[model samples]
Target: METAVASAASTGRAQTSRSRCRMSPKRYEAKLRLAEAFVRLVEAMPAERITVNMIAEASGKHRKTFYYHFADKEQLVVWLFRYDLASGLADKFPEDLLVREQDSPDNPLAEFPFYARRIEESGRIYNAPFFAALSYSLEKRRAYYRRIFSTRGPGTLDFYLHQLFFPAIKEDILFLIDREIGRQSAVERKALRERMTSNAGVDFLAEFYTGAFLSRFVERLNYTSARRTARDIIPFENVVHDSLAALIRQEIEKAAREPGSEDRPGKGGAPCASPA
Candidate 1:
């Protein structure tokens, strides 16, 4: 009896391990199909109009398969926004453009146009469908975000913004500031850090960048036209680069003035420091 029980336990463990396997190619492809289907449907109809059955049919998978993979439609929507869209952008955009190399002397923001030009030139990269989906999340989908922002939904608007739109922009901006201040004497660096991390300091950096740079960028990109999109690339790039640089300079200047309040960053690399 003891020997039989041991064998059965081993078999059960093996089955559990197999079920928990990391996403294989087949699994990833299925998820991608679902995400693409959701994106397509979202463009044609409001999110509230979309149904799980529609998504499953569009992806050519059964509704049960979707349930097996995702808990519900909301879960699927979050995954599409958080992982699928972010991953696609990361794959297409140059990751190195967002960070400063120790030896490079050029402005970090200067690299924005270089990559922006790539997306503009590639017919398929920032094409109509792609731009529609991206801009809608930032623009048309404001109502959905506002709802979650006001109350506790599965995720937060702040997170959706960070993961979807602000990842590279936030990283580069913070890195530029870090390098600039890092050269200062230890005393100045410490003082600046504290000032930037304080309450008054927090509002200056966070509100300016998110409200100014990010918000304006999305608003400008909301329009969809091939001719206008090409024309807007350089201007949009300038807006992004200039706004971030301006924000950094403003914060640095403020830090210089205020000895009491300094800025530390947030857990997810947001400009705002967490409240004490």
Candidate 2:
């Protein structure tokens, strides 16, 4: 009788442990689906318009199940921003040299096209709701930076990382739009030409308009001039093709090196999916 009782207790403990192990993967997968669905939904509409029911319906999960995983919509948005956006940014900045490369004058604006393509691809897979969610997430990120570093000196590393670098990337996109699409319009073309040709106008415009748009943050961050090396300027098309090809090769190598469904905890205990 004593041996049977001990055996039963051991079996129960093993079963409980196995059950928990099984549940962890299920929960992780559910969260992944939720994040993907949320991105789709936001692309279609603004984050404010998204509700628990919408997420549940899009993910094909019940509202109760979503509530079980996330406390509310705000929490879900926070998780997605911290895990998805931050991780993507980290992946792009794989090396310190990559950061410097971004600031190099010779580097073509091909990266912006890659991001635009990513957005379009996500839209096709999900919905407009995802883009709307991303916009709100970006706004929140900006507000967070403003609150944290509003009064502090601008020359800090934190200031550059949180304030200047990220916003500069966004501004670069706007710059590309001005150069490409905005120039095509006759009214904009004439105004831009007038503004550029005026005495000290280009510098003034760069300072006020281009620089001023992010002056609040840029004023605080340390500005370092890129090294005066003879950097090669690859054509935008070639750069895109090469960079993407390299990325694919790297991914293949990474998969061969690490092949398993290991639960790697990302920012905020979120499971980080391996690159496909």
Candidate 3:
């Protein structure tokens, strides 16, 4: 009986450990070191020219360890971009102001001050020379973004940007669409038909707008002079935000008026808009 009890306890412990998704502290630290090494390596050479072996060597970890943490180099790039951009913004900027309801009378694009302030603070976090001149890593960041955006295949800049920003705006977009759908009368619903699919396809509008904003923002960063202060470019951020908001609002309104657009549902249905 004692042996059986001990066996059962061991099995239970193994199962619990397998069920946990979190990484061990040591593993997390290893991954972080690998990521930092990747940034440094990319600065010296283009990301395409670098390999898994180079990263592992620079990080002082086994080459197999890179695969243990990430599926491929592209996945590492995704992690690097998020760490470089969103992680820095998380502390200083208010989460509530990041995204707004599509139907909200308040202009969604009016939060440039928040974005600008976050950029101003980002240099201190990443130790990148944002104000004086772009650091080596910052230069690499621009080059990588441009390369990914210009590529014809998968893993485009827009796809990655959508992934980066999707979480913050998801709830707000859902709420806006659900509220709008609920407001329609049964007759209106029939007039709208299945096109009212998934909050009237607001997500397509949001994702497209986010992608355009990210692509343009990256392109601007690539060409922007290093001497330009974050404050000096505040107006440009405002203009980009406003332009994205206006386009999104216009597309949403256009979808609402079109019957053909109504049949296509977003989020696991046939897309009403192009992913590109």
Estimate the lDDT of model 2. 0.37
For candidate 3, which ten residues in a row score worst on lDDT?
A: 12-21
Off by over 4 Å in 2: 1-27, 89-276
Best model per lDDT: 3
Off by over 4 Å in 3: 1-28, 94-140, 143-152, 156-158, 163-203, 225-233, 236-276
CA deviation > 4 Å runs, candidate 1: 1-27, 82-159, 162-174, 183-187, 211-214, 217-222, 227-238, 250-276
- What lDDT tens digits, residue by residue, belong to model 1 across residues 111-205? 11111112232121223333333443444444343333343222533333432333333334554566546756666676565444434443345
On lDDT, who's better, 1 or 2? 1
In model 3, how large is the Cα lDDT of residue 13?
11
lDDT of 1 at 123: 20
Q: Model 2 TM-score?
A: 0.27
Error of 3 at 131 (Å): 17
Q: Where does candidate 3 clash, by residue pair? A: 195-262, 195-263
Reference-based TM-score, model 1: 0.51
Tens-place lDDT per residue, model 2, 1-276, is 122122222321111011111213354688768867876776666665789899999999999989887767655643444444333433432222121112223221112111211223212111122223323334444433333233333432222323323333333333332333232445334433232233342233223332332352233222222311112221332232233234333432342234331222111111112255
All candidates in order of TM-score, best leading = 1, 3, 2
